[model samples]
Every structure is written in C-alpha cells, then in structure tokens.
Target: MASEGAEYDRTRGAGDTAEATGEGGRETAAPPDPKIAAAVAAAEAAGPQHGETVRIDSWIWSVRLVKTRSLGATACRGGHVRVNGERVKPAHSVRVGDEVRLRHEGRERVVVVKRLIRKRVGAPVAAQCYID
Candidate 1:
C-alpha cells in the first residue's frame, strides 16, 4: 500500500491541451466554423424566425441569468421571475421582445429579450441575447 501510494500516477486533465501539443503552452482557440458562425450571427441579429418559444427557466439558464436550470425553475416557482409584468411558471414560454424581471442576489435584473437562445453560450454571446 505504501509503494502504491508513492507510485501514484499524475494524469493531465482534459483542459491540459498545451501538454498534448508538445508542451506548446496554452493553445489558441481555432476559428469557429463558417456555417455555425453564420447561424449564430443570424440568430444574434434577429429574433426567433418562426413562432418559436422556449421555457422561461430554460431561457434564463441558457442566457446565464441564473447559474442553473433548476435555479431558474425554483425562482419561477417562488414567484421571483416575472414576464411582461406578470409572474409566470417555469414552463412558461418566453417570446422575443418580452420583458423579464428576475429577483436574484438581492437585486432585480430587468432585461428584454432581444434574441432567444435555447443553449447556454459564452458570456459575450449570452449578453447579446438580452437588452439591459
């Protein structure tokens, strides 16, 4: 047991890309694919193309308004989330241009939907999804 503990293996984490690339130090992020870039740009430029909607909890979580989907749902259930001047449920569908008010961390965050995104994105991208 002592020998085994002394011989413990040290493995790199998934994020240790530099070590994988011949100790190149931090690796730069490759440019995004053009097709995906175009899609994201279009999505950021416009609202939902069709009569599309996403759950309020999902939208809030996707846009980083909350740390997790469950937190967003809890806020909705606790009446801490409101849409268009009315409290809504976690499953309530949030449409583009609707105003959302979230009471979180002892302050109220009021924002309007500029774009609808169903997936969590980077802070920059998430910031584009709403109007502060």
Candidate 2:
C-alpha cells in the first residue's frame, strides 16, 4: 500500500533493489557539463567582489543597462546619464547604493546599484547586480 503523498515505483519487481534503479526508482540528476562549469567558475572568478569600485559607464554596460560600453560612454558624454542626481562623466566612479538614471530613446531608466560587477554577464545575472 502506498501513502497518499508518496511516489510509487511499480516497475520494481521482486528482488529488485532500489539501488539498482535509483533513489526510490527515480533517476539521479546528471553531473554538470564541464564547459558550463568552467564558464561559471571563470565568471565567478572575474566578477566583482565586495568593496569594489567600477566606472559608471562600465558598470552600466556590465549590468546590461546599455547595449554596449561605447553607448554608455557616449550617453555620459552627452549628458544623458546622471548618478545620484549629478551628471557625471564616463570615468566617474559609481559605488553600491547609488541611484543611476539614464535617458535613452526618450525613456528613462532608474536603477540603484546593489552589486558592482565589472564584466558583462547574462541578463539574469546582470539583473541581480542592481535594484530597479
């Protein structure tokens, strides 16, 4: 008799041990791919750690707020970007908790720095680096 919430393994016949099949007759999770593991390890190694300072333009691009680093720099130079209520240059330093405002394509994006990352990451990872 199987419990109401328990999974039943009907395939298990007499003398068939659970170890021969898997955990409770379910297959085990496969090991991570070597290439993916290496890429993740490399990203973690190169990613910004605590108490790191990153350039405003660089940070913007790294967080995926801008499509490219050059666009970020251009926006800064054109006075289309502001950090903490002050217009700053591309080389300006941006720290955690600073509010960044960028006006692009007639729209404004406001974000608060939560983590500082230097290298460009995937959109999901980039989203973790800021609070919008």
Candidate 3:
C-alpha cells in the first residue's frame, strides 16, 4: 500500500501536490527567474539609479505622447511637436525634465517631463508623467 501511494504521489499534478502538502508547490510560488532576480537585485543595490537624459523624438511615440502612439507619430509627421526648441520627428527620444512643445488643432501647448513611461496609461496616471 505504501509503495502504491508513493507511486501515485509521484504522478500527481501540481495542484494535487499543493493540496496534499498544505503548501503551494513550486508551480504556484516558484522563485523568480535567476536572471531577472539578479537584475532586480543589482538595480536595487544601485540606489535610485538616475536615468540618462534622452531626446524627445525617442520618447514621443513610446510614451504615448498623443492620443495613440501612432497619433504621436503622425503629429511628428505633421510638424506639430518640437523638442528643446527644435522641431523633431517621432524618432526623437525625450528625457526627464526636457521641455516639449506640441501643436494640435492649431493650438500650441508646452510641457515639461516629470517621468518617462513606455506603457499606455489612463488619464490620471498619464498626468503623473508631465507638467502642463
């Protein structure tokens, strides 16, 4: 009976292992990937690593400058966006605290960067990235 039960346990699924062991198995609480863990630890040890300043063209599309990322691209195409007093293309990369000028629908606006973000964000979260 003991040998048969041991064989059954060996073939059990991950869920079964968790239930039987009273602790979530490696499938549920696995350690972070070693490479990612090392990277994170290194970054943490780096002590508030300040990023290098970048140009606005490099950040426009990536940070969702306009409505859509593609819209940011179009705005650059249409000469509606300028970085650091120079009209730039979508390829311009923006750095933290860089000044930006944007023209849409014949209206011009200015902003300063407070943060750099690559993901599309909601209205409230998006506000955190720039100063209008």
Candidate 4:
C-alpha cells in the first residue's frame, strides 16, 4: 500500500521536479513576453544594489516632497517630476548628488539629492535626504 501511494506521489510530481522537491529556487514571474522579461532581468542586473539605490517615487515621498508615494508616481507619470534635467519615471533610481525638480500646487521645487531614503520619515529626518 505504501509503495502504491509513493508511486502516485512520484507520478503526480514528475512533471515539475523542482517544485516537487521544494528547492530554494524561484519560478517564472509570468512575464508578458520573452523580450520584456530579458529586458527586466538585464535592468535589474545592471542597476545598483538595494543599499545603493532607491526608487524615485519612494525617495520623493520619503523626503516629504509629496504627501504619498502614489502621488509621487502620478507626478512622474504626468511629467511633473524631473531628475538631472530629464523627466524620469517613478521607478527610476535616484542617487546622491542628483538634482530633482518637482512641480506641484502651482509651484516648482528644486532640490539636490543628498542621501537616499525609502521610508516616509518625519520632516526633520526627511530634510536630511535632500538639500533645498
């Protein structure tokens, strides 16, 4: 009886050996296209590591420039955000010494990146991330 059950388990898992063994590996992310997946992989491999890079949207919201991260992303999508004189997407990486410009509420804010931060911080702490 045990051998029969074992055989059944093997038969069921034979098609996907990796998942069956529960190895420390990841599966495909359901990317839309092979080319797109390759591009994303290349970007990730080429980009700076986590400690060296922060997403522009997160940095903006972190430094209290925007009320929320979503708003920061919206500003980027609307072309109200610029980095180093070029409009950038929300996912663009921001580094120290980069200049950031934000247009909001009938005003434009220009600040240079001093430090990279990810979390929303209090005003005092946020101020340390950029120089106005």
Give stretches of model 2 more than 4 Å off.
1-44
Reference-based TM-score of each model? 0.66, 0.66, 0.54, 0.61
Worst 10 residues of 1 by lDDT: 23-32
For candidate 4, lDDT tens digit of each residue in 2-91? 999999999878857866555323324335455555544554455456668889998899788999999999999999999999999999
Backbone Cα, N, C clashes tallied per candidate: 0, 0, 10, 0
For each candidate in the order shown, give its overall lDDT on alpha carbons. 0.82, 0.80, 0.63, 0.80
Model 1 lDDT per residue over 1-132, tens place: 876655553224443654677433222342244544555665455545577888999999988999999999999999999999999999999998999999998999999998888877767667778999
Question: Candidate 1 at residue 90, lDDT?
Answer: 100
Query: Local error of candidate 1 at 104, Å?
Result: 0.6
CA shift of 97, model 1, Å: 0.7
Model 4 residue runs over 4 Å out of place are: 1-51
Clashing pairs in 3: 55-93, 55-94, 56-92, 56-93, 57-91, 57-92, 57-93, 58-92, 58-93, 59-93
Give the alpha carbon lDDT tens digit for every residue of 20-100 in model 3. 676435334533455544443443353223664444544554345566667777888788898788878777867777789
Worst 10 residues of 3 by lDDT: 40-49
Candidate 4 lDDT at 27 equals 29
Q: Give the runs in model 3 whose Cα sits over 4 Å from its true position.
A: 1-65
Among the numbered candidates, top lDDT falls to 1
